[model samples]
Target chain A: MIEVRNLCKHYGARKAVDDISFTVNDGEIVGFLGPNGAGKTTTIRILTCYHPATSGSARVAGFDVLSQSIQVRRHVGYLPETVPLYPEMRVREFLRFRGKLRGLARGERETCIARVTERCWLGEVVDRPISQLSKGYRQRVGLADALLHNPRVLILDEPTVGLDPTQIRETRSLIRELTRDHTVILSSHILPEVEATCGRIVIINRGRVVASGTPQELRSRRGDGAVHAEVRAPVEEALQAVRELANGAKVTADAADGWTRLRVEATGDLREPIYRLSTQRGWTLRELRRDAGSLEDFFVRIVAEAQMQAPQ
Target chain B: MRATVAIMQRELLSMFCTPIGYVVIAGFLLILGVLVILTEGFEPGQPATLRNAFGLMPFILAFVVPAIAMRALSEEYRSGTIEGMMTAPISDAQLVLGKFLGSAAFYAVMLGTSLVYPILMQVYGSPDWGAVLSTYIGLLLIGLFFLSVSIFTSSFSSNQIIAWITASVVLASFAVGGFLLVRHVGGFWRQLIQRANVMGRFEESALGLFTTGSVVCFGALAGLFLFLTIKVVESRRWR
Candidate 1:
């Protein structure tokens, strides 16, 4: 539903987004992951047609963002980081205004407003002024406004910034449900929300894409395949036995309360060798687990590697 | 066109939902009432006309119109609503025209309420209906011209107070400074200043002299400023 090719945006001497390219398929929820100032918002703004790219091109829903912006805008719904809303307007009135601006007919606007209000769970405050609502409610209203026209693409920037735990969970579930129909591109710094809601992840740093894949694929590709084991035995004996069993593996061991834990960073499976060593020594093996990298770990490693490769 | 109308409706609704619109209109009427009715000495037996009322409108409008228009785009920028509007499907021209018309409609209401002055004149004495109509036309033209200037300045700054000050300085420079400069200069400079002075064009209609030259001048200036406002808004996409 969205494609960007070598998109470059420069504000004077600084490049906000530089030579970044990505494609999102229909009905796919792509999580845009980046730390602050990683050009995530800048890329989304260009795709939404709010700003022009200094070089290269982007298209949303098959409409060129530069030349055919109006059509692109018509097919895409955007919710900016600040949730741009007029506080004086009631929730229903604001939705109606957005609907009319999107070129919906009077009857269609009425029905769409009702539908979105219900979908976003904004029925209780539909008649009240938006300024009187809480931050979570306002965020929902912003989401409701984006869904009012039922566009083919929904682009949200930091959708769960200020919400409480429950609201964040609700927003995550809502976004997950939206993947059934709409193609969503959302940027957020919260890794867990992206892990819980998005089907795929694209991590960018310093105006470039550092990694892009499914969470599992990324974890496997970047993971070091480390093994961790806990044994109830003499600390020095257990450590010496495991180190000898796993040849040429970096091992670190700690002991407390008649128990010792060992962490082995190895290129291959060390669990079987360690288990055999424990059985031979008559040591009680309490736990043995292989570590698959987490999204947070992957994100941090990718971003750190990018920073190291970046020119000073 | 439908998009323009929707934006205009939203703008107008937002303006009235706040206290600013009502306060501006009420203050304008109260000041005009005091200046034209109570302070300007008129004998009981003398013929009554709206000359005093029309004479004082330009000076008041120079400040008041900008106050009404200062928030048009500045508030949008301050609240980040401009991002939403720009990302919508509407064209920059449509957005500019929508905001201009919304503010213009509010100004019209303010002017409409002042018609009671002429109605009182008609009841107490015989006033020239032609002059009254022409004076109103001239006032509307001036209001539009000032509003265009205000909108341009508003687009340049996100701070409402800064927008108001910039607009006031620009309008006052043209309306008052031109006449002041004309007094010190001679020959071509004097004629140039007189021709460009907005106050002189406004006074021509108030004195029952409705010339095509003045109408075209006001129309052209208003169009120029509005066009400039649109350009500023369009240029924002690059920045």
Candidate 2:
């Protein structure tokens, strides 16, 4: 479990992470979604105790990041954005080293090393130096290192950044599998990656959390609720009928090739009522659709809005 | 703690696994031998003593110790492995101590190889065993002080070359400055230089005095630098 309350981190005048709060329950995979330089990594660093928050507080597994950082670190495993590895250390040797730092006894360290090595699919290159491994394998090594201690909470910042499509899928499944025993907080700009794997999504922009919800909840409940209806009817008549159906919501009409394309910003799902009205009007319906915006729309909208709010 | 030992072992492992460890050892021995031969401490008709060779240690170590410790924390910062290291449920003191001890252990190995020269003195002439022991003890102490200084500089940046240059410059001041500057000034400045300068303290040890004051000086200096390194590591997380 993790809880962040009104956390703020500033670099001189620049606020890297503004006042933001979000909670993640045990065994839940929460995706921290944001574009470049949107404070996603900054927030993760605070949670992992790599950097202290400028203000407020964060707790992981009931331990404060500031006071009980060592305990917080023990409960959580982090795969940093860079995924740095010692170029000279062999894969197995690196894991063994990580295990030691995690305070595993000799026998337990060896067992955990083998288990993580096998789990992360680092079998072939176990004896090879890290410098020789490809990007995908390096990412796997980072993953394997994080899982070496069998930490209760896993924080991965862009876990699949350099991986090819297959590797990405494998990593997604790997993260999903980890939810059985670990609470995962995955941060990434990739829409589908978060959409596919995370149980809940927290969208941040310009050091602020813009929206937070499940994928389906986010898709269903946002952004103008615009319904598009193309009917071969007179503009004035259809506009009047749609305005009546839409009630107080905004309505716009565009006539093209004897068909009036009506866009009604309905307060709720008005597809059923709009269909009946279109039938009653005896207008030939060419296209009738309600826009259920994707997470991509939400992501782009938040970024664009944040950029406008803070301009050079 | 286990974390500290693990980090220390890894640092030592890194040195031996790469050519850096062997190169540093060989390079130090070559330089020390060259300096001794050039000073003509081994020529005939002169008193056979390792004092001249021992006296040049601070100057040699002004370069050698930095080379050994330049990559301690700077490389980790550059490669972004500091994140991995700092997040490992270990304290800053553990990280700094681990690195310091690792470099010190490597220095011990480097110093260990040169011990044969002292033994060689045993074969040829009746070298003052007191001065030899005192000089070696001083060398070990001053070596750690130089290492601590280098490790401290290494914490300031991600560039190992920059760390090496910074540490070398600071140490070369202490190594070359005391002998060069002490005689020019009198009174408090002279006492200060003699007290602060590693070579000045080594001169006392080489005279077979083996003063405890010099041990305290080097020990306190090494401890101060190690403390500063821990603070620097903590400072990054704070501000």
DockQ of 2: 0.73
Candidate 2, B125-181: lDDT as tens digits: 777787888888888988999999999999999998999999999999878888899
Candidate 1, DockQ to 2 decimals? 0.85
Q: For residue A139, what is the lDDT in candidate 1?
A: 97
Best by lDDT: 2
Tell me each candidate's TM-score: 0.94, 0.89
Q: Which tens-of-lDDT digit does each residue in A1-312 have in candidate 2? A: 899999999989999999999999999999999989999999999999999999999999999999999999998889999997998999999988899888999999999989988999999999999999999999999999999989999999999998999999999998999999999999999999999999999999989998899998887765666899999999999999889888989999989889999998864788888889978878888888887777788788877887888876
In order, the interface RMSDs are 0.7, 1.0
Worst 10 residues of 1 chain A by lDDT: A290-299
Question: Over the stretch A1-312, how does candidate 1's per-residue lDDT look in tens digits?
Answer: 899999999999999898999999999999999999999999999999999999999989999999999999999989999999999999988998888888999999999998999999998999999999999999999999899899899999999999999999999999999988899999998788888889899998889988899988887787577899999898888878888877878888999898999999875778888888888889899999988657688788888989999998
Regions of model 2 farther than 4 Å from truth: A223-291, A310-312, B119-130
